[model samples]
Target chain A: MKFNNRNVHLGMNVRLGNNVRIGDNTTIYDNVAIGDNTIIANDCVIGEPSWEYYRHGENYTQPETVIGASALIRSHTILYAGSSFGENFTTGHRVTIRENCRFGRDCQVGTLTNIQGDVTFGDYCKMHSNVLIAEFSTIGNHVFIYPFTVFTNDTHPPSNHYKGPTIGDYSVITVHCIILPAVKIGTHCLVGANSVVNKDLPDFSFAVGSPAKIMRDVRELGGGGLYPWVYNFERGMPWQGIGFDVWSQQQ
Target chain B: MKFNNRNVHLGMNVRLGNNVRIGDNTTIYDNVAIGDNTIIANDCVIGEPSWEYYRHGENYTQPETVIGASALIRSHTILYAGSSFGENFTTGHRVTIRENCRFGRDCQVGTLTNIQGDVTFGDYCKMHSNVLIAEFSTIGNHVFIYPFTVFTNDTHPPSNHYKGPTIGDYSVITVHCIILPAVKIGTHCLVGANSVVNKDLPDFSFAVGSPAKIMRDVRELGGGGLYPWVYNFERGMPWQGIGFDVWSQQQ
Candidate 1:
């Protein structure tokens, strides 16, 4: 009850790599393969039972869930079955990820962020707190999203159809922005805070306002316009101190 | 363990009313008083210990927590010590309320919302999903806040100075909006979606856009505007079918 390290309830065929640390009241379901040096905190549910299991109960089979090397999953997080992540995936408190999601290396999902099922995320994506990505969102690499951003899939209310927004690589969606259904944002675009994006934005666009209008090229912006954060702002970024020029060359 | 009814871990001097049903793995801390017919679902923490308890451990005394009759708190919610709620309070999953917050009757909080400490709310307040209210927020009666809206108390980040926004009666703040510190929104105001409100808005104003502009009087808007939501849109409101005029006359 002290929130100390407790032996969690693990199902069959669960393979955990070396030096994995799991905290109190954490439950890992069957067929979950967690890589080396990963730390999962208290009250987490990895490979949580999916929708079918709820209806079928004990007859359901939980699908595979994989978390790659050096991942740090924080407290009160819930990752549903059939999701997979690459190396160094991280999450803050109370995050929720549904089934059939894929993530690349070095992704950081912030507190209270909810990713609905069937989403794909590329490497080094940072989704800060309270970000909600509805079903079928496809995110490219090095994308940064600020708090209270919503990627809505259903354009019409109470409809079965969903068309989640897609963001290309190295783009930054600022705080309190809403990306409407089926909107595709090109690479290296900067979406300013409190903007409502209703249409497709071309590459390198600096967009703002409700029903966002592109003002200019993102490269013309003062502090942002990302490619390794546009070689301008790199505080706490993955490739910090080691220059983007050198980093891109290596990649 | 199944998420069935279970006796939670309770501290000394705890009290519960008749027919109060509790679900699995909920832990209620010291001096908590839960009123009659209240149903708390699984994995909740009622009367969670305060910051001093975390800092000082056993020496810290938890303040008295109270929840009035017919409150329904869902799974994975955490209500910190010294908070109080009036009758018919409800919550969706994974909500967190910090210390010293007060809520009046018929307040409904949606999923993944986090209310920081020292906030006060009047009757019939509804906060939809993923809303974050920072410290010292004051909300009046019949306030409706939509998803992904944020109430920020700090004008400058990482600074000591804090001033949470105050909202008057029957105000509806729409989705993906950010209310900046020290801003006051007057009664019957309608805040449009994806807006960044930095200035004080007068009564009955329909505000929209970044650095939100007052479009017109809220009563002029087609579907929305308060005083029973302007008697236009009243879907699922408390005074539904009974009629607001009849309800208000009775009150």
Candidate 2:
């Protein structure tokens, strides 16, 4: 609905729901379904053909891509084929999401962030600007990744081995941190900025510094670092103006 | 110079040198000049009117933007007004360069890079993907900034103060490092990955760790940390297959 459609190119079998606004010069490729009230900004490429298109040029077949209701894709963003997002998915400007990525409801990816192929994120995850997620990353619900935080998939790069770090629910990874390959971070953990996570972190841990050491439980930090930050913080979240428990019961 | 001019908006008094190739859907505003053999890729916005455009919309007047010969601007780049670059300048995908930025000859900026306004770079400067250069950053010649490295101009953010880092010649800032406001790094320095630079570093220093410590002289690290790396490494540089001494002498 209300789509200007100037210079917009849509391939065969593309479906858009009600009240959708597609901006100028946007391209939505074949076999992509976007749900209601979605706003795709200018110069965006949805359901891009990825590597097959690179190798075969114009002769490549398209893969099925799906986005649930109320998605907001920003300008110049590129979303490759075979990715699925639940309702209320949003992204910042010039973000790149590679093939086969999956995200649950109410996920927000910030500007210039890169998500490599086969990444999975649970509900209510947030990633800030310039974040890098390597292939095969598994992130649980309510995960918050700050700016320039990187998740690696290779222990020794240029080798065949690939095992991305697995982050448990309600964890927060701060800015400039590098999570080593295959590291396991438990729920309710807080990773300090610029830290190098080389080993597994336990639940509710507050890790800081290079080769991060657990300082204390995250809940120990008053005025901040509360358990399930969703309960404490409510600036722009869905439960804003209402308690998280109250909001969840209604849901 | 041949221009197809499809869906391209050209403002008044725009100048182009010979052998220039501008891709589709590009917008070049007024008072701009591009040099010979420059290739600006698709969906680029050259001389974007920035803050005035936001306040005034279509009534905004653009400032003068100039680029020298053989520049390659890749896809979806937005270069604001009043920026100038010397010859052999290139950029990667989705770069956002703000107003009043200046770059010398043979500069290569990588993908998803964000260069804030009033930044200056000397000759042969290379910044890899996902780099962030804040306002007032002054970088000297032959600097290599790796991925996700950031420079901040604010000592205390959200305040009135501003002082960006000044990097001397032949410095290497590695991945995921954060250069704090007003930091002065001397020539032939090596800032290791994941470092946080808060103070001034003398010449030939090799700094590492958060609140970076000067570990050793840069020349001490073999196979790397060499002064004027242009002489030691020459795979893709203009001096490739020829020694830097020979190349400089010939020049």
Among all candidates shown, the one with the greatest DockQ: 1
Reported per model, the fraction of native interface contacts reproduced equals 0.20, 0.08
What TM-score would every model get versus the actual structure? 0.68, 0.68
Candidate 1 local lDDT, A133-225, one digit each (tens): 878999999899998788977553223468989999999999978998899999988899878999999998889978899998876666544
Question: Candidate 2's residue-wise lDDT over B86-109, tens digit each?
Answer: 998988678889999999999988
> In angstroms, how far off is B164's CA in candidate 2?
5.3
Number of the predicted model whose lDDT against the real structure is largest? 2
The i-RMS of every model, in angstroms, reads: 6.3, 7.9
For model 2, what TM-score is found for chain B? 0.91
Worst 10 residues of 2 chain B by lDDT: B222-231
Per-prediction DockQ comes to 0.14, 0.09
Binned by DockQ into CAPRI classes (incorrect, acceptable, medium, high), candidate 2 is incorrect
